[model samples]
Target: MKTQLEELQTQLTKAKQYGTDQETLNKNLLRILKERANAERGIIPKKQHHGYIILCSQQLIKKDNIKYSEAVTAWKTQIQTPYPLNLKSSEIKDQIFKDFVEKNIFIEMEICTDSLDIKTECEVNLQQYLFRANTRTGYWEIELYTTGEITIPLNMQQPKKNATGSCSTFQKDSIKSNVR
Candidate 1:
């Protein structure tokens, strides 16, 4: 896994150095996108064109050859960004890719919810294992937070009335229930 990831990182670096040119950049982006999508969704390339590529998983292609052009278009667009690919920005991009890669890694990992506690004031303590992947390294974070009460503006949900009696009984009931 490490070797494969390293090779991908090197390829990504080379692709960035190749600049915003159409052919070289798009091809490199397609390669990286294919690998990442395959890792995430078990997809494989079926055909390639000058500006587009078709991808489908082996099973799906064998069954019906359903291609996802939206995925290809998104990948192509991301790689051809005009911005300089610095380490910080590259790291951010890699983080997004890593998220795609590590999604399934947590499927079998048991969530440790034994430490969670709920308070009477509508406050709840939550802990969750977040898995993230990128060009550089995979990431795992145990996020802990307390969810406090949420308040929505009443005017956004209902029209304001100059007179209190302008609101019907049903409207009063809806406001009591905090429902629009």
Candidate 2:
């Protein structure tokens, strides 16, 4: 609860800088005050597990026909994609909140396979939730329980520097779930 209060205060400060509308700012200020009061009274927000699907890139190349002798280096360098799942989508929020449960929030993500454009769906039970409100948009940004670095294997044929894919950005009731 204290963490949440602090986040709210931070949002409020950012909201002022971002020129958020007065009406929305007022509402958020009221909400923050109420939450602060609750925190002082030892009241905590109920934990929730909102459901959403994270679209991950599986593979870009399909065929591997290069000979071993033609390879410049046999050793592979690991490329870590920072927060590949740090997605913000309003569509996802709508889908998740449509079936939102009050007491528990579990995020479901799919793992990618070796094949290009293929995904293997897996159910990961997230036991924790970190949520915040977007000060400018009044949207909910739910941080993922995992905030670790993701290692992405690079394609030897196409070794571009800092190659990352674009993710969907959703505002107005959004979730900023990242696996960075």
- Best lDDT among the predictions, by candidate number: 2
Each prediction's RMSD over C-alphas, in Å, is 23.0, 19.3
**lDDT for each residue of candidate 2 in 1-180, tens digit (9 for 90 to 100):** 999999999999988877767757865653554354333322334111111212122211112323343422111112111111233454334433333332122222221222223354533222233444434323334533322222322221112332222223322222222213
Alpha-carbon lDDT, every model: 0.27, 0.32
Q: Which stretches in model 2 have alpha-carbon errors above 4 Å?
A: 1-108, 111-123, 146-180
What is the Cα-based lDDT of residue 178 in candidate 2?
27
Q: After superposition, how far is residue 166 of candidate 1 from its true place, in Å?
A: 68
Q: Which stretches of candidate 1 lie over 4 Å from their true place?
A: 1-86, 93-103, 111-180
Candidate 2 whole-model C-alpha lDDT, 0 to 1:
0.32
lDDT of 1: 0.27
